[model samples]
Target: MASTDTNDIYWRAYFKAIKLQAGGGATEPGMGKEYFYIASNANRSIAASRFIPMATTNEYLYQEADNLMDPNAPLYVPGAGNTSYVQALYTYLRHVKRPRDTLTPEEEKAEKALTQKLKDAQATYRSERKSAMADWKEEKDFENLSFGAWAFKNARTFYAAWEALNTADGALQDFLASVYGADAQKYRSDMKKISGVANDILAPVPGLSMTCSNIPVLDVAEGIEKAKKGDRGPPVGEPVGYERPAYSLDPQYRDTMDRWAVEYDSTPSTGNAKVTWEQGSKTSWKEFGFENIEAGGGVTLFGFLRIGGHGGSHTEYENVKIDEKNSTVDIELKWKKLQFFNVYPGTWNIPQIRETYPEVVDLDEAQKLLIRPTQFLCASGLSITCKLGGQAKEEADRLYKKQVEAGGSAGVRWGLFGFDAGGGYKKEDGTQTSTSSYDTQKGELTISPTPTFGNCTLLGVRGQAVSI
Candidate 1:
């Protein structure tokens, strides 16, 4: 043996190196002593055992086994690869027994039904979602449309005038342009364009008309006049014309044609009867005349009294009769008192008299009365620091106090609990009284209380007064 130990040692070292390269643990089967024994017994070279050379003859199983033992072979597996091999075998067998394309009629029908159900569910979801979104949009659109309709209805007259101006061609157009200036023409053009755009936007919505025909339009002439006069502003603070039946007393005594008067027997009587009509601080008093006059005859004195500070005047008619035998003179006078009140414009819809009362009534009246102008009043010992405006302030204070004591509104009472001409509650009789009226000329609502015999008192009478 020529150095056989060295050869054996060299082969063992080569095998150990191969095992380490193959990631094999020391206890695992990698290039073991059994491989060396087999190779030596079969008269195979050590290199052939390590490389696992392919079979030259037609031994397919031998070639496959040799390839499996080769570490360098593409499909070669270590001991850990057995699990993957078993899994492949099971997969092949399963595929051979049942193909992927094979399906029974019942299974095909079930799959088709499931696909249809899924499509139907998807379609229903889309439709319901779309409908819900549409409903939301439609509700918002309805509110907008309602507002637009109200606006158009209220301003129909102005819109009509604008339309007419836009369509004008002849002398009328030139005249309008001259009177209203170039700005008016531009305004007309802009308004038409805006109206067109609004119509286009509302076209898709059903039940909305392109032309707001249902809205009431004012007269073109009236609209033009209002625009020219700059009366298109808000109606608040505008002066209103109001008229009511004011009470007047006859200068006659009870059950006699003789005029009623205060008689004074002597030139300076103990108590001289004085009749005074106060307008603010100004007062017109007539003392009992001691002049001698023929019996059954009277002297008529006519005069116009100015209501100071307030605007308006009233005519006073006085008749005086003197009886020389009795040393007496009788005086009678006729005068009017005006009551002032603030009013608000709105549809006064009285529920109590709506059903029973007739004549298509709509009273535009005051919301509330400003009873106390100043909440505080200053006073000094035995005298007052404030100089009041005579009978006007006095009557106003009296009315306010009365209303406060009665737990009602100040000034004049209105509504169901209000008193009518017969001194009865308006609700008692189905007849409606004109508690408030609208002033067409001034575009304001006014409250004018009809003066009765017992309620008439002279004071600072403001507003336009027509003598009755």
Candidate 2:
């Protein structure tokens, strides 16, 4: 029966906390604007004094407990008599025994006098609250930052009740303290228990990834985002978009390029003809077949048309399936023009071949062009076909998956894995290889690999690292 009653009190407190946290429901007016909507709000000052700090403390408790449990327990809410406890607490925090910047002589005297009375009442309340919670040592040990914060909040209400008593010219401070100060302690005690409950809920369970250490990394950003957007929603990375630049064609080059395209396309159908450049009536064309026009037989180009494959040109084409009807039967040919000037037999064919491969017009042989590391490696390793193997290969795949999952902008993971250490592989001999690793924090991996026999030594070293 007692447990049932405590559960009811807890749920009431939990609902109130939720309403305040979520900014919803019709609150009983007087607890700030949440309750301001209500007309007959009698306990306005008391409710505000009580619930405000309780709300804050409750939030901290929630954060503290969030990692421990899946379904966190509820806090305790003070009833009508306990509501007076609220006023008493506020009074103590806001008035008597409260911190003051500047106190007049009379005010200082009054404050001192009130402080004594407040302490006495607090002692009595603490005693009674311990009895109620059935846990004395634990509640008593809660001091300094945690206990001080609790006292400061409850004291706000205590001060209020203290003021109301004195103003009404009742044995007000003393009488009010005597009446509800114990309840104030009970409220404090209950709050402490609720905080403990939250802590317990958030405490890490055996073998579970849910720990105080890891949860913040996973949930803090999401929680804050939800709070900001007015919903407990997950976080999405930075919103991104691309604006297409306006496209405009140069009207001047249109005529010459088109006439050249038609003339080149009509002539003897070279090796292969493509309208390489198309703009209005103007177009650019390319045909590959013979080498030299004047000498004949060798591939030569006149206004984008080439004839012959002998001299410096080589024929390479892939027959790609054009459509379903002709699948393997009829294939469209796709090929690239290859001009190796270094292998050409004579210098007389060089000038015409240079025109065919215009890249021969480099003024500075010493100029180093900036190339992507991946592209450079791929090009340099033409024999081995050194393609980007792991993360780089997955970049486009990961991006497409994220786009499809998020559909708009919600599904992106924009950071690297925490455990990634940079890696490199080196092979001095054709059959022997070694590997190196690096860490961001520790700085470097001191890995020295020695060959057991130096022949056919294949080593695969793998380990996981964590980052803070």
Residue pairs in collision within model 1: 261-331
Identify the runs in model 2 with alpha carbons over 4 angstroms from their true place. 1-28, 31-89, 92-111, 120-468
lDDT of 1 by residue, 429-453 (tens): 1111223322223322222222111
TM-score of each: 0.14, 0.16
Q: What are the lDDT scores of the predictions, listed in order?
A: 0.22, 0.22
Which tens-of-lDDT digit does each residue in 1-468 have in candidate 2?
111222122222222322222232322211211110100000101100110122222232222211111001111111211111112223222322212234567755764666566556555544543443233124543322232233335444433433433333222233323333334453333333222221122121232111111101122223333343445343223111111111111222222222222232233312221111111012111110001211331211111110111112332211111122222111011111101100001111111211222232213322111100000000000000111223332332344344435433222111110001112333232112222222223322222221211111111001111000
Q: Quote the positional error of residue 212 for candidate 2 in Å.
A: 29
User: TM-score of predicted model 1?
Assistant: 0.14
CA lDDT for candidate 2: 0.22
Judging by TM-score against the true structure, name the best candidate. Answer: 2
Candidate 1: stretches off by over 4 Å = 1-148, 151-162, 165-420, 428-468
lDDT score for residue 56 of model 2: 28
